[model samples]
Target: MDSDEKDSIKNESIEEEVEEVEPARKKKKVSREDDHEYTVFIKNLSFDTTNEDLKECFKKFGKINYALIVRDNVSGHSRGTGFVQFEKKESVEICLNQAGKIVLQDFTLDLMPALPKGKVKQIEKEKEAKKVEPKDSRNLYLLREGMIMAGSTASEGVSATDMAKRLRLEQLKSSMLKNLTRFISRDRLTIHNLPDSYDDAKLRKMVVAKTGSKPIECRVMRENKPTPTHPKGKSKGFGFLSFSRHEDALAVLRKLNNNPEIFSANHRPIVSFSIEDMNVLKIKERREIRSKLNNPTYQEKLKIKKLKRKENRKNKSENKPAIKGTRKAPKQVEENEDAFSGFASKPGSVPKHRGTFKLKEQSKIHEKSMKTQNKLRRRQKHELEVQQEKQEKKFDRSVKKSKISDKDSLVAKINKYKDLLKGSNDESTKKQKSKKWYVD
Candidate 1:
């Protein structure tokens, strides 16, 4: 072949290769441009919502390429948001237009146009740049560069001590915000106007899905008595939930309260802190009062009062002159003084007790009789002990006799068994001798 023909053919082949490569490059460019246009970003999604649910919700708009629920890498739980890509860009526009009105799985969707990572970053930077500063800018400080203080060791930049102080202040501010949030929330919540279909399990699940925390207790208040039609009792359209931590309760209240779309209920559910019962407060106060009244100090005070009252009665009796009709005989007055010393001490102070001398003489006689009765009881107890010992000795003697009899019986049985064994051995030996004689 000629050199000129070879060069011409090579030039034509190069032109064809360029033509093939240009179309593929153009196609890639077109695909890149359409990537963000057909995809829709969804916010405020329910955690239980799945990718299939997302596709089913927006299938009416256009053909879906795929739907995805963003999930945590470690836990594999939904992040409460997702993305949906459509075959046509017009479907995404339609979905975004009906964003707030669309409800899927009882959750209202907040839709936005999906953007590339670089574009999203650029938009955020622009927003930060466009933010208007306060009119009195002198109060604002920048962390990167600020006026050098007189005490700063570094002449050109912020000192190490100042940096440390700034970091400490930031930490304190963050901690204060966390504590403030905790204080703002409550452990128990009262929910009003709940749906008829809602029950304890559903309420707990909803709270867990919203807050990622389980409630300590959850219940739906029902009718006092169940009717034939409603065997489980009809719901009163209210419920309560108690959470372990204030943050969980706050998260549930923020996410579920006043959001009718969560339950698709006709009315907005009201969630607020549960009010403590007045009866409970009264019971607590009554218990505290009862405890105080039964205290040792109060008991001692009561005993002191009784002693003072007795001393006061004694003084009153001593000041009063003896009346003619109330005068007692000398012997009777002495007996009265002895009997009433612990109570009133003075004679005839209390006429409730009469015939004191006769009663004292009878009490002395009764004491002598009681002592004699006790001595008789002690004698009876000693006799019972002696009888028990005699019975025990008789029982021991009988037990020894029974043991001797059992031993004689066992010895006789052993001898009889030995004689029977010897007879059997002699019979076997005779049979063996007869068999040997027969063989010979």
Candidate 2:
């Protein structure tokens, strides 16, 4: 072949190689950049999720580049949706394969490719716009639009479309009403002094019979442990019952209050019922019941006084002073009439003196007992100090013994090394002298 032709052919071949290699290089760079851009949408997340939770959940698939949970702006609760990005394509595929296979808190996870960022932002904006309208206005608007979509007005007869729309609207209204009514109708009935063996089901049934509806829920009050009462650990003998309807709750309250059999003779039935909106009643009842239970009554005070008087009589009889009766002469009385008359007091007068004296003696005895208690306390304090000192001394002695033993072992090791070195040197000297004689 000619040289010019060969050179032309070589140039063409080089160009072809360059074209082929450049496209591949570009493709590899593109792929590497796209790897980090891949994101997965995770659903059924917990409402209380944090960024750390999202990272931990996606960490099993691959190195999580970033993670975030969508949150409500006002409520600050997670919206149960989030995104996780990975730096590897294989990780994305693996996550999708196990999408619904993973479960968290009884909810299955749903993983899919994240939608475009524009679409997500658009959806969030729409949601925010919807939320900005007042709730009542929003509901009325929905109702009106729904009716229009149904091809009928509230007064006009419903068309076939209207019937379908009405059904849908009714369902929505029912759900909304159910949620709204929960806060309005139910009342918390706190029945105190309930028998320990009282059956919750039976009580609910009884309440239902009286109110025409079963209680929505019921729970037994936990015993004292600082629960709304004194004598911590004592169950106030009561529990709470939440009714499904307010009328039913009020009816139950009326019947329970009027029934005499419900309360013991000494203790009246203390049935307090209040709507959830009126939480102040719970606080008030707690204070009132605590005060009534702790305070003493008028009858109790009188009984205590009688008991104290009886105790006094018993103590006086035990420590009665002996009195010897004596007769006074009339002539001596006449000689010092005024002085003698005062001395010749009636027996009753002497009894009063004896009572006063006995009271003073009792007071003195009580004071002596108090002093004896003080001395006993001092003695106990001295004994405790002595015991503590003895324990400290014993602890110190053990510490010193351990230190002394450690020192002795170190000294013994040093002395043994010195003796070995001296013995070895002496032996070496003797061997050297004997070797010199042999050589000569």
Candidate 3:
């Protein structure tokens, strides 16, 4: 070969070697700085998924360089998030396109391109910047669009979107205020901490006494049961009083608010303008809806309930007989030889037919018996009272007799002792007189 041709061949070989090294260097630079472009961040991963499991899940999509589940350092448990790095950036695009459709170990994955370094911090800063501080009186006008502030540039002009938002905010404020005011009833007052003995009649009388005016309507909230002590219902310690005039309601509120004498000790009544509670309003609305006959479902339910009640009534009537009271045994009926062939005949016996009594006669008999039993019970109670009174009187007479006997015995003993002392004194006086005479 010629010398020039040998030189050209050497140069060509050197050029090919340089080209291969350049491509290799470029690949290393791309891997180091552009790794985020080829990696995908998967969220909502199953905690039980391991690196091998994740890799197996995505291996069908593309060649994966690595699959890892982000784990807590101390506990060695999955953080429910991980990263999947592919050999090419195209694989990341393909995986992201599948996004929510990818399921790994019974978990739907949310896939996104892995953020480059410092990108997350930038996003957080942008979010913080987007948050608006609460506007008060000073900056309130500034928040409203189309309001020209002094010494400010108007080059941007007023944005229609900002103006619309401001209008919406105003509407929202008005709606909120209306809702708040709607809860207050104009001519009604709520009374709390009422006496347990106060029912509708007593509560109305109290309102008339305190306020010196009759209320239009008064109701004490109560349990849904009728008790012996309270025939209507038991008081729930609260009530509502409504007046025809708003001024009268206000006057009643002032008279009853924090009134310590109205209720028992330590129970001061709390009276205020009746504010309808939302939960109570909801319950009232539900009851009203249920009560409306126009609703087909409610009508059907009522029909079913009526049918059940009818069935229950029929069962009760069939199972239980009337005239449940004490009565004499029924007289035995005589059997006829022709009608009852098996019966034996007795001489001089009349054949009497069995008779059926009417319901009215049975009912009258039961009522008469009940009345007699009640009279007997009352007579027995009266007799017991009379016996108790007689016993008490006898006890009193015995106690008086014992006292009189004791007093008489004490008086007789005193008189006998006094007589004995007088006799002894006379005997001593006689002896002294004899001595004196002898001396003389």
Whole-model Cα lDDT of every candidate shown, in order: 0.63, 0.57, 0.65
Q: Which portions of model 1 show Cα errors greater than 4 Å?
A: 1-31, 123-440
Q: How accurate is candidate 2 locally (lDDT)?
A: 0.57
List the lowest-lDDT window of 10 residues for candidate 2: 333-342
Task: In angstroms, give how far residue 310 of model 3 lies from its true place.
Answer: 62
Task: Name the regions of candidate 2 deviating beyond 4 angstroms.
Answer: 1-37, 121-440
What is candidate 2's TM-score against the reference?
A: 0.22
Best prediction by TM-score: 3
- Tens digit of lDDT per residue, candidate 1, span 117-136? 68999999999999874442
lDDT of 3 by residue, 382-435 (tens): 999999999999999999999999999999889888877766447776687567
lDDT of 2 at 193: 49
Q: Per-prediction TM-score, please?
A: 0.23, 0.22, 0.26
lDDT string for model 2 (72-155, tens) is 899878899987778777889888989779776677888888766567799999998777433341122112111111111221
